[model samples]
Structure formats: C-alpha cells, structure tokens
Target: MRAKAFDTKVFKRILEYTKPYQWRFNGVIVFAVSLSVFAALRPYLLKQTVDGYLKTHDAKGLLFYVTIMGIVLLMEVFSQFYFVFWANWLGQDIVKDIRIKLFKHMLSFRMKYYDNAPVGQLVTRSVSDIEAIAKIFSQGLFMITSDLMKMGVVMIFMFYMNWKLTWIVIVAMPVLVFITRIFQRKMQLAFEEVRTQIANMNTFVQERVTGMKIVQLFNREAIEADKFSQINDKHNKAWIKTILYNSIFFPIADIISSLTLGIVVLYGGIKILNGDHFTTFGDLFSYTMFIGMLFNPLRQIADKFNEMQMGMIAANRVFDILDTKDQIQDTGIIEAPIFEGNIQFKRVHFSYIENEEIIKGINLEVKAGQTIAIVGATGAGKSTIINLLNRFYEISSGTICIDGKNINEYSLSSIRKQIAVVLQDVFLFADTILNNITLNNPNISREEVILAAKKIGVHEFIMSLPNGYDYNVKERGVMLSSGQRQLIAFLRAYVSNPSILILDEATSSIDTHSEELIQRATEKITMGRTSIVIAHRLATIVNANKIVVMDKGLIVEEGSHFELLNIEGGFYKNLYYSQFLVENNS
Candidate 1:
C-alpha cells in the first residue's frame, strides 16, 4: 500500500516533540512579543513627538523624544537578533531529532520496503523535507507571531487616536485578506509542486551518479539528460507559478493600502478643517507614516501562512516515516544473548511481496559449530533464505530458532550482534582501515584489528600501506581492489567473532590465489560457530559439514559431499560432477 499523509492529529503529535524544550520555547514567545511591542513603539513616538513637541515648537522636548525613539529602535533590533537566532537554533535541533526518529523507524521496516522504494526519495524526505519543516519553525514562526501581535496593538492605538479613521482602515482589511489569500493558496500549491519535482530530480541524479559507469558504458547520457530536462521544466514552471501569483497579490495589496491612506487624507482633511477630534497636521502626518509601515508586515504575514502550509505538507511526509510500525518489532530483552551456534528453520515460508513466495515451507536443521553450504541457481532464493534467517525480513509463516528460542524472542540488536555477514558485494565505510574492521565497537585495540586482518591474509598488505592501520579507505573503500575489499570484509566479520556467520558468495570475486587464502581463513574463522555459506562454487561445499542443494525454492537433496555424491543421479550428484570435476581431479 502507498503511504498515507498526516492529519491534524499528526501535527499535534509533532508539536509534542517540543515539550522537552518548553522553557526555550517560552523564552522565544516572550522575546517575540517584546520585540513586536518595541517595533510598534516607534510609530507612537513619532506621533507624540510631532503632536506634543514639534507643532508646539519645544526644541529640547523634540530632542529628548528623538533620543528615546532611537534607543527603542536600537533595542528592538537587538532583541530581534536573539529572537531569530534562538528560533533557528530550536528549529535545527527539532529537525535533527525528527530525522533520527525517521532513520530508526526506516531501519525497522521490512526489507521489502527498501527493495521497492527509491533510495533518493528516502534521503530527500529525511533531509530536505525535514529541513523545509525547520525553515517554518525558525524565521517564519517568529515573524508571523510578532507581526500579528504588532497588528493587534497598532489597531488598538489607532482607535484610541481616532475612532472614525479606524473604521476606514479596518474596511480595507477584508480586501487585503482576500487578495492575500488568493496568492497564498497559489503559492502553497506552487511550492508543493516544487517539492515533488525536487524529490524526483533528486531521484534522477541519484540514479545517474550512482550508475555513472553503467551510463557511460551503455551510452545513455542523452536519455539521462532528457529525463533531467523534464524535471527541470517542472521546477521552472512551479517557480513561475509562484512569481505570477505573488505579482498579482502584492501589488493589489499595495493598491488597497494606498486607497486606505487616500481615505485618511480625504476624511481627515475635512475633520481637521472642522476641528475634528484627534485630527491635526502632525497627528495625521504620523498616522500616515505608520500606515505605510503596515504594508510589509501584512504581506509578510500572508507569506508566512503560505510557508507554513508547505512545511505542513512536508511535515506530513516526515511523520509518515515516524508512524510506520513494521511487523519486525524486536521486543526481546536479552542482556547477553549467548547462543550455541545452532540455527534451525522449521517449515518457514517467506514472500518479499504478497501472494508470491520466494521460499516455501522448508525445514532445515544445523548442529552447533557445523558448516552448512547452500547451493542454488540464481533466482532460486538462496540470498532470500539467508536474509530471512537473519531476521531482515519476517517470514510469512513458521519459526526460526536459535538454541530452541524463537528468533523473535530475542532482541534484534542482540540477535544481530551474534551474527556476522560477508556478502558477495562487500561494503566498507569511509574511514581508517582499522576503524572499518572495528566499526562501532570502539573498545577494540589496534593490535586486535591487526590480528583479525592477519587471520584474513590482509594484515601484510595493510602494514605495507603508508599509514598502516590508520590508512583511510576513502568512500566505500574505493581505493581497494575486489579481493582486497573482500579481505577487509572478512576481517570485519572475524573481529566480531559472532556465534553465527554468513558468507553469501563472498569468495565469488576472488582469484584462485585469493580464494585459497580465503578458504584457509574460513576454516579458522568458522571454527566453533554456525557458518552458513551460500555458494555456486561446488568445491567450497565439499568441505561443508552438510550440503543442501536447492532448486525452485525447495531443498531437493541434502547430505555430506561424499554421501550426496553416492546418491543415484540426484540433483546434488549431477551438480557436483558437472561443476567441480576439475577440482575433484586436482
């Protein structure tokens, strides 16, 4: 099923994340209100300065008035700096917390979710979508709340000065709101479109850059450029839509504002002639200037509404990730999960997608400290079986157990901590050679890392490097060859010394020389552990304590190599004779 968007309930839940920072949030509210009051004070000062001092021709009074107004303005600007600064800081922190939750939840999802989903889309949602929410959390929040407060105070003071003129200004407000909202809706739609296009663009770039060598080899540059052009056009159109709508709204707002000022001049001129209450040259003049300053905050308040709406859309996407509850929940509380290196699958059935089984109702049992080899053709579900055994995907039915305890009964972390996997395509971190071996287990010493490396036959090579154990592998260990990279993967798993081990075609990439070294390492490493090897190389399975030959999701034969070879024309016998005759002869 496609993911669902958030409701108002989700927004409330998201706000609850801020509960821990209530004190900081309260400070922001107080600072924002104070800043707003200080901002509106300048207009009041001008009115008082003009009516009380300038018209009455008191030079020292005007001087004192100017000085106070200057101080207030300076203080307002200063408070604004902190107000914006703290809001931004809080926004970044909130995004970080939300992103962490998203990441953790993503990991909890079943492997099928990742297989079907796009990597670029997930990254953009986690990073950029969350950042969009943060932008509103920061500047947009302070500006909107502060300006709205200023609007309220300005209205009250205007009424106090002149009630009749207040109605004139108030009458034009509905027109401004109407004009403002029309663009606000348009801007929100435009930004939403832009967000979608940006995600698509990210997906395109991700696919292209990650497969750049493939693109060059296949001469697919023209197709990639064409795809990018389409996304770019969509982004351009969304941007133009925003500009076109804003152009209509802001100018109309300005015109309506000018109309209000015109009304003030018209009605107030008559009032002044007739000595109307609160009407004079200085009062009217100062009110007119204040009215002029009102235009920006009004437009900005509308813009903030538009911004918040877009952020809310992005926030909904973020919450979708957080709200997902995968079936693969690990509730086990084992402090030290010590297993006997025995793994059994009892009538296990698994399907990556609904109604299509890749592994169907299979039974297998392994003793502690036994090496089992899984042999199968491609698409025969060998890797899927391994993945399910490791709890990467929950089975459709049946039980996987270690030492007779259901796999689900153990905490995922503890279960995973007891297993180490080295796949055909090995992955390495962008770090020192030593750190790649140890990963997150920080207590590991340099000597221990070297010990694992030596066991895997890469210690001599690493020692020859310029920096030895400290030598950086760069991103994904790109500087290393396939065999060297495979050696590092071996070292990592060896260092973990997990009770259960998985080597999924890990030796498939190595040459004859490297394979010999790897085979020697495997014998040492798999000692005293339940080792499961998925391989096409029949020679490797000759030494396995048990060999299971699978085809079309069922184990057709199982036994030790000699025992299987003695079977009359069975699948394992035929596979061994055809694939490993040379190795057998040698």
Candidate 2:
C-alpha cells in the first residue's frame, strides 16, 4: 500500500486524546517558546561581551554580562528538565488511555471478528503500535516544534548581527531542505514496511508457540523453523532500508553544514581585510554560533519528523480497529435477570459466509426444566445451534426466543448471564483453581464454590491437588490433565447456577472415571434447570427427555431413546446400533 505523505485526520484524532491533559500540552508549548528565546539571547549576550565591553577595556561590564549569561543558562536548564519530564509523562498518560479504549472496543466485538483476526496481530496493535504513538509526544511533535522555533530565533539574530554573513548560510539551505524532504518520504514508506513485518513476525511466533505440541507431534520442526527464518529475514531487510536511508542522509547534511560555516568565515574574513565597516569580529563570532544552531535543528527536524510519521501510521492502524462495525449491537431494551429456561428456534436460518447457510431453517423447542439431547455427525450444525442460542453469532433470518420473548429483545448480558456452556475443549486461565472456577466473580465466594464442588462430588478430587482449590492451573490449565480440566469446567458451570446449562460434547475426550463424575454432576446440575446436551457418544444421551437426531442442518428424528430405538430405519436407531456394535467389538 502507498503510504500517505501525512495523515492529518489520524493526527487530529490522536490529538483529541490529549484533551484530558490539555494543561500539560499547553505547558509544553510555553516551554518551547521560552527555550527558543533563551537560545537566541545567549548568542547575543556573547556578542555584546566581545564588542561592547572588552573593546572598551571595561572589566566590570564584561563580568556583568557574563553573570547575566550564566543566569540565563541556568533558567534554560531548568526549563529543559521540566520540558523533558512533562512531555514524557504526557505521552505515557495518553498511551494508557488509548490502550484501554482499544481493548474495551475489542471486547465489544462479536466472535466473528476474532474468527478471522490473528491473535498475534491484535497483540502487536495493543502493545507495539501503541508504544510507537507515545514517541509522538515524548520525542516527535513537541520536540520538532521547539527545534523549529530555536532555528527561527537564531536566524533572526544572525541577520541582525550581520546580514552580509547571513546570506552565505541561507544560500546552502535549499539543498539541505531538498535532501530532508526526500529522506522523509523514503523513511515513511520504510517505517510502514517495518510495522507490517513486525506484525507478521508476532503472528507467526504466537501461533507456533501455542501449537508447539502439534509441530513436534507431526515432526515439522525443521519446516516451521525455515518458515520463521524467512519471516525474520524480511523483518531485518525492512529495518535495514530505514537504516540505509539514515546512513546516507546525515553525512551529506553534515557536509552541507560544515561547508556553509566555512563559506561564512571565508567571506567575512575578506570583508574584514578590506576594512568594511559592516563586518566586526563580534558579529562573525555570533554568526558562526548561529549557523551551528540553525543547521543542527534542521538535521534534528528530519529525525523527529520521521518519528511523527511513524506515530501517525500506528495511529491509523489502531483507529481502523476502533472504527470497525463488527460489534454485535446491544439494542435490546428489555432486561430479564432470570430466564424461565424455555427456548425456541423458529425457522432460524444462519450463515458464517454469505449465501452459505450453516443452520438451514432450524426449528426446535425445549420446555422449562426439560433435558434435551442433540446428537449428530461432525459438521451437522450441532455446535452452531449452541452458538446461536448464546448469541455468539447473529441469525440471518427468523427468531430465537426465551420464555416467549424474542432473544433479541432481551439484553445481551442478561441473556448470557442466565446460560452457562461447557465445550468439548475446556479453557482455563493461568490462575488458581478457585479463581478459575469462580472466574473472579466477587459474588461467588470461596465457601459457595466449595459447597458446589461438594454437591457435584468432586470435592475429594480437588482436595488431593497440591493446594486443593488454590492450585494454580497454569496456562490454559496445561498443568492439569484433560479430565481434570473438564471437571474444573464442570464445577465452574455448576457454581454459576445458571437457569440454562449446555454441555457440548463435554464427555467426548475424558477417562471413564471422569466421565462418570461428569455424568453424576451433569445429573445433579440438570435437575431443575433446562439442559441441552450435544453428545457424540450415543450411550451418554440415552436418558435425555427428548432425543433429537440431526442430519446436515435439519433434525431428522425426535423422540425418547427407546422410542427412537424402536424405529428400525430411523437415523438415531442406526447411529445407536453402530456405536453399540463398536463398543461390543472393542
């Protein structure tokens, strides 16, 4: 993508974040002007000491001027200290605000957004890109402003001292400005490439590390390493391009600055030798200092401008996420703190992709406190049904209702609050088991969790762990076995005391003993609450009040386990017999 020369829109949006810290921003401007004035006054003082005092053979006058210059230096030093401190402080404050906003926006987005976004890319946006934006305040925009003001004041002093010598310095400026302009454009593009490559590397590393077990099990370590090396090389080359441009620009700039100083000295010396009244030794001395002051800020401006450009680019990317319309709109006004556990899907049609329905006109119902079991082959829209019920994805057409009210009419949080789901693959945070079970909900106390665990008959199992309920599960609960994690998930769901409970293949991958515990826990949890159990194991759902067999996205059979088994040609009958035969043979 071609980078914009400057993104004023993005820059303005970033500045909007500074409204809370407007006083600090205004203070930065005040300090910039003060420092510029100080810079100009020092050179003028030096000129006065040289010509006005020393030429008159007045020691007291010279000492007075030197003392005044020393005081100005001290004031300038203090201003600079506060300037640096406040500018950095302002940047960090702004960064903290933007990071919070970005994360909160991501939290509001529907699962559809995360379905396509890489986790590592989001990490880069939140951490690395936001850090680049901080430099805009600490080192980029305000710094450039201060340097420009200093250069301007210094030029005014140079011309006032001796306009003849000032012309020599101005003569070489157009060439330097032209070089800086070229450097800025190239650097912007280079930095853009650098940001993209950094995101790519982050995404690659995050995925590989998260799935390292798969890499080793498949014996693809060499292949994955080669891919990573290629990504690393691209990242290196992108950075080298920026470094190469810096390497070329600074030396040429130094040469121009040195040549300008030499020209002023040569031309002024000739004028002095000719006894021209306009050229004085003091004026020449001040002009040389002025040239150094002038050219140095010009060079530094190039560096600071590069930083501002990077901040603008990073801001643009962050705003893209903030501007996304992928959030599931929470327009429902009705607040139902409790659901009666009645659910109905009326001609519900849905799709993850356009014109490709995943749930084709699904119509089903479960009465209050009924245990309904949905069984189907893989990709038969079984899990999609659960996702739809939880409002993880919006339906394309038709309506879902809980307790005779359209699900969309109920507040999103209220709807989710009443339902708890335990999936086939359980996920637990890297925290103590108690915290994972309660999810840090302040209302679910430790005593209540222990009570729920005891009721579910897993209290003894948890007590056997290193720290009982306080055991740290580690990342994704990898410290525990799969069965152990599932039990924790069961307890997590149980403690919530949700009005509706969903177990989506929760027993598919556990040991027989763990399955028995889950079955008993499931029986207890489903006693008074409506439960929907989606199972691949035929035996597990035999006791469900209603057994619904789905084929593709349509329900092909519905009955009690015995009633379905009595139908010889029925889908559930064949499925149950097949599973039964497999168990008998094994």
Candidate that scores best on lDDT? 2
User: How far in Å is the alpha carbon of 120 misplaced in model 2?
Assistant: 1.1
Clashes of 1: 0
lDDT of 1 by residue, 1-586 (tens): 3222224665576677778788888888888888877877888888888889988899999999999999999999988888888888888888888888888888788776787778888988988899988876685666788788878877777777777777888887877877776667667677778788888888888888878989999999998889889889988998888888878887888888888898898888898899766586765776786676566688777778777767777888788767766647777766455679878889989887789888889899989999999998888888988898778888999999888888888888888888899999988899988888899587788878877777667788788787988889998888888877787788889998799899999888688877877887788789889999999888776889999888888887899989998999888888777876766677
- Residue range 109-210, candidate 2, lDDT tens digits: 999999999999999999999999999999899999899999988888887888878888888999999999999999999999999999999999999999
Query: TM-score for every candidate vs. truth?
Result: 0.94, 0.98
What is the alpha-carbon RMSD of candidate 1 to the true structure?
2.8
Off by over 4 Å in 2: none
